[model samples]
Target chain A: MTVMTTAPDKRDNAPILSVRDLKVHFPIPGKGLFAKDRPLKAVDGVDFDLYPGETLGVVGESGCGKSTLGRAILQLIAPSGGQVAWLGKNIVGIPHRDMQPLRRDLQIIFQDPLASLNPRMTIGEIIAEPLVTHKPELGKDEIKTRVKRMMARVGLLPQMINRYPHEFSGGQCQRIGIARAMILEPKLIVCDEPVSALDVSIQAQIVNLLQELQREFDLSLIFISHDLSIVRHICHRIMVLYLGNVMELADRDSIYANPKHPYTKALISAVPIPDPEIERNKERIVLTGDLPSPLSPPSGCVFRTRCPFAQEKCATDVPTIDRVSETQEVACHFHNSI
Target chain B: MMNKSEKTALLQSASAAKEIEGRSLWRDARIRLFRNKAAVGSMIILGIITLLAIIAPLLSPYAYDQIDWGYIQEGPNWENGHIFGTDGNGRDLFIRVLYGARVSLAVGLLATAVSLIIGVTYGAIAGYFGGKIDSIMMRFVDVLYSLPFMFFVIMLMVVFGRNIFLIFVALGAVEWLTMARIVRGQTLSLRRREFIEAAHATGVSNFKIIFRHVIPNVLGPVIVYMTLTIPQVILTESFLSFLGLGVQEPLTSWGVLISEGAKVIEASTWMLIYPAVFLALTLFCFNFIGDGLRDALDPKDR
Candidate 1:
């Protein structure tokens, strides 16, 4: 994959969000009284730092804990273990009441646009909800003015505010979701596959809208998606996930240009190039097996079961994330060789 | 100071705003309800019945309990001015049936209102916060559900003494169980919907989320169940009256009239027919209205 250049890398300031060893495990009940219940490790020991005004893209196949990680960062889903530090303060385990004020700074955009919006609420009310919660001091007229302005900012007609979400198209509903998330002028916004539900044409539009808003608001965005092509454009850095673990995390150019992990290679190889000549000539690494279930993941390196170069040693030993360069981290034992 | 294009834009948005302003869920449902012929007809009939119930004394010359020994067990006759004729005791049947309407309708509405308040709050809180609290709350509901309804009402009547207000409390206390169950079931499904999750992400309080988000979403089912419950409540009231444990003399209900009517069907058929017709009509109207509301509020239909 050719490198899609982004804005100049700036790491002058402290990180806005830091996630360390974040694990979300759900307990599945046992069959009988004597049987011990097993915990489904959906996200196990993941770590990342999100700088202010940077977009971190998380890429993974279905059920690989991409959405779970995004939700955990925003405290939307409780992480069974680990720390989610927002602006250097650990926000994990904070009661929901205390979490409310923090929510004004941290917001999320969901995958299903229409589902994210309340069907009963008018577009105006949906967008104004965050304002209603956080800015109680703001009068009704002030909130309405802010909502209408936000609506216009997100490319929705201010007049259409009175219309229900059902009346709007998928793209428009997504804009409303964006408007709601952006209403509080949050420092960080989690875009959890915000464009996966839209048409191909609308996907570009929404992605462009997000990029523009990220720049305008100077917002740190966690863009989570399975679509590598779209992620390459929007994300400054990309994290490849397989079976609830990070296979690789690197600067976008380096990850695309020189993908170290076999899992990352297989994922990038799947993205179809727009040019037929390059598409046909490009080498595609097709893995053999499906993603292992998170319930009882492979004991060693989570990706080893599906890794093309899996050895007997790979089954017994977990490959910790090894930093290959200043801008890249790969979690594979033989990343140097293959 | 606005440009021509800006002025046009303002005018256009202003006009466009008007078209969609009143298109709320209730407004749409009302429109759909009116479109349903049966529901509309039922509404008109129910309205007129409620109106007549309110002004029955003013309309009728003979008092509801007035006894004219001269016309005992009389059949319908224009000369005596008893349009619906006289009951076994020579009291006007028309006036009694209308007065009964006041009692029966009030009980149905007020009891349902009571159940609605308790049931919706109980069920929404239980479902929205699921797990231990939900399990315990629902188990409590199960305990209540197991309490034999007749026995409970009888106990209440025995302890508190049978009065019009006690009937409302007894019926409402029991009726809310099913309403809570229906609401809980709906809330269980709705709690998982992305919108509810979105509300949580927005930092809306748990209290606000339950009332603003959960309850409104479950209202479609709650409303349908309520219509069905009213007739059920009315029937229970009649059953209690039949057992001679409800609504003492002087103050009458549809149930009391119906029970009295049942005993003397062979003698004066008007006593039975008048109140029975009114009760059946009211029940049918409620059923038809419920059907209309179910159709109107159904997301599937939309």
Candidate 2:
């Protein structure tokens, strides 16, 4: 079942998931009978590779397609175009019957924990669903034992198995979600802002728990979030997105310490440093324009309208991603000059 | 020895806490429903009425249609054992009223069940696979809605020759439009919930997701609507029977009984009084139970 595609020569081993030029366009209904149909480009031509056991952070503003990218890779939302190669097999256009088995190894945890779980289902049933779907051969007793063990591992009391989602706090609900996602021991789990809805204290606990479980199961994560600080804590490699396009992609240290793209630099500058003296002295690049609508994004470069150093050439010529360093790539025409 | 006792006490407290935590949504709703006095009273009355309906024929010594020539138009008395008295044709009014209840209650329940199956399936399909399909299905419902309801029933009767089973089917078919609308609305919202997305992510089949996730979440409103719908169906049946289109002769329903009784009101008021009281009481009981369920199952209240 291996898909024949060009494998990057730099990596020693094949990546767990490799997505190239992925696009998810939602067609908007025409306003009039003669009006032309327009498509909302939610995730337009995004490319990335996730190595085994590595956490790839997707950081972007709301509607910037970070969430769409995560969903597109998992095939939750079908991509309008391009390829999603999972374990060297293209899964984007696979039949649902064929995709079912793949789901056991690919799972996702949502942002709003309470909303992500079925209120009618007991906590035990919620966590056991994936196992029941994927491993139907296991006996009832075996399933119950696995559910209890997973519950305990995720910091939920096994005694709360019969309780409903509404009965628990947000953090506990997230733990239940994590337990459900991890019950299958997935190779790659897309954490779509899994901690954004939790309290500040609970956020750390969930992040720490995710890190612990990743080590225990050797899980690769596509952690999508708008919170730069939280993404910085858990992600190894970070990708910055603007208007459904990747503005920058690099290792976490390079992204934060020396951002190559102007948009990435602006995003990093917005994260306030804890030290008062350094924070006051640091320059903040606050671009003056609102984000261009995806319906008709700025001609050529999608981020040109918001880029601080936009030029006449920027409006006409889309800058393709170029390697700025051994581990960093930027998609700005004037990256070296600016 | 004191330390051992303390440990035992702690274990007991922990088990007690677990007991408190184990109360499920259904159990909570049950507790709330039990606490509603009006609902409980309505339930009791409903139970008694149902019991009477089941045993009504056996309880009466006289046949529902038996012409007691000796006691024609007699009032309530012990002489002939006619408690509720004899009707215009000397038939046992009491037995006829009880038998009539069987027809009314059966129609109410069976019609609701039929509607439930049709509405839930139609709505789930329309809502789960939305966009063009949803628009087309709902538009059909809306078209059906525009047709005069009574005329539709009459057309079915005229076309099918007024069978009792057809009455159930007609009433059920007409009533389900509203049920479908309610369920479709609920399904529309439930489909968007993250749980449904999570279910989709798990690669569960669409059929399984609709039945297993969407239906259960929408059941609260559907159950309430069903209770309310039963009374409406019963009333519609009564209205049709009054117009001589429902429950053909020899097999009488409450509606038939009331219709026949209304003609001789001046000569014998008891004929109309008895059946009307029973019908009103049954309708009230259903409404009370519906209200109770609405309050009990409201998630916001919990």
Candidate 3:
């Protein structure tokens, strides 16, 4: 059912998408009133591997380069440096015209559903637009029939095809989004906090829909979210990013059960346990202060300022992703000790 | 203010009838605009002007520029087919005024369209790109924007030959600078919306994103600006035509007609009164349409 079901060696096997030394920077206004050169390093040297039929969730606080990483891999925001090879094609610095065919291969589900759908267009038109634009050879009647089928597939009424984005609820809007993404039968989809914009009940429904659809459509997903528990539920492997760099990357159970990096430990421990007695028992690992500006990140480890395990080496040379074992990777001098 | 019980009853009625179905945004806006008596009345006035403008050539028997000594300085009567009477040079005022509508409408529509096209594209690109591209392009706009429009347009007239197409193109080119600036601001703001990024993510090119996503959202402002621009173009054409720098004698405009009418104002009042009233009415109708558009496109007006 997956993109590569022919091969059984999936997650622990060869990577379908390999991102190495990926960097994305946004030039910020410096001393000069009209300065041009400098930029903020939004995603700096982040590395990961995503295999077939697997959800690789990247969890981080806001502006920690998680979103930037997802966008960069999809070539949504052009990366400053490094390689992002998707199905063996390095799409870094790809031209807009060249990226069109590549777009159908990989799609992105945005965070805000209300703003994602075009307000002026009907539901059918919004979904059919991409198909018609991408495949102009496909006739009008075929496009209409496909759109109608997709709407029904996404749980929207046949009559509601003519309705606008404003007419739909948040949950319905997200269903429309899912419909749009799967219509092309993309190989991989980068979900930018797909459930973050919906209500609590709606979140579970959407998460279940994503799971069901993933099985039905056989999708490879890059799930980007701030919620650790949701990531724990959906992802096969999880990468913890902090200040434009990956702090930890491992299997969901291993990362949750044995959090190596101090930053990961802090993130995991912060999740409120539902049971009152258990919640009262577990110590809350709170990190210090706010996230540092990506424009002028710390010299050694990006998280040194807030990291409780910081020592002399933590302030000097930055630690690379050291393989502690066959399955886990951590970027910290005292990761083992912490 | 209503009584507490009445207010509660009204609230309950509204809440119970929260059926937001089978209603379109455009349909609702049209209804609201139609309810405004002033805007509707102006529509009627505009209709009359359009009809008059269209049939001006067929109704008038006299050639607009034909000079006749026998009918020179003639007054309104059945003689000599001088319906609205003759001007100082014995030319038919009625014929000339009718012919002027074609000129006024031509200048209005043509100049306005050219400006809108240039301005909208320029603004969308500048705003959507943001950062350095936005800053540099906007700065270029700011420099040109500081100059007085009439002064710049007049200079254009002096430089270019007094041809109708040249005048329209020049006016359009100069006026579009304003529209481009306005559109850029709107695009810049729209770029921040999630849909733009979603389009970008779906590998929709910058050009498609601008046209599909940004343009449709920013169309309200552009439409309002276009409506406003038409009246201004008409006025500008009239002024230049009055100074004998715009539409020539054989092809008359409101400005040329008004200028000729003003010369013999002391002797004949109908000449000045008719043209002035029509000009005022044309400008008024455009403004009303602009106001109606402003209200219609505004989402909060619901």
- Compare the candidates by TM-score and give the number of the best one: 1
The local distance difference test score of model 3 is 0.82
RMSD of 2: 5.2
User: Candidate 1 vs candidate 3: which has greater lDDT?
Assistant: 1
Kindly report which residue pairs in candidate 1 clash with one another. Answer: none
lDDT of 2 by residue, B1-302 (tens): 23536645654455345523556677788898899999999999989989998988788899887999998987877677898888888998889889899999999999999999999999989999999999999999999899998888888988889799998899889888899999999999888789999988887889889889999889999999999999999999999999999998777888998998899888888889999999999999999888989999994754
lDDT for each candidate structure: 0.87, 0.88, 0.82
Between 1 and 3, whose TM-score is larger?
A: 1
| Count of clashes, each model | 0, 0, 4
Model 2 docking category? acceptable
lDDT of 3 at B182: 85
**Residue range A1-338, candidate 3, lDDT tens digits:** 11221212574666779999999988776787876667899888888888877888899999898888888888877899999988877878877677778888788888888888888777777788678667879998898778866765556665566778877899999988888887787879999999999988888778877876777777789999998878887888889999889899988878989999999999999998899999999987898799998878898988999988789998998998899877789998887777
lDDT of 1 by residue, B155-253 (tens): 998898878899999999998888888888889999988888888888998889888888877888799889988888887887888788878887788
lDDT of 2 by residue, A41-116 (tens): 9999988888887888899888898888888988988899999999999999899889989998999999999999
**lDDT score for candidate 1 against the true structure:** 0.87
By DockQ: ranked, best first: 1, 2, 3
Residues A12-90 of candidate 1 have per-residue lDDT tens digits of 8888888899999989887898888899999999999999889899999999999999888878788999999988899
| Candidate 1 TM-score on chain B | 0.92
lDDT of 2 at A161: 79
Clashes of 3: 4
Q: State each model's C-alpha RMSD to the native.
A: 2.9, 5.2, 7.3
What global local distance difference test value does model 2 have?
Answer: 0.88
By TM-score, the better pick of 2 and 3 is 2
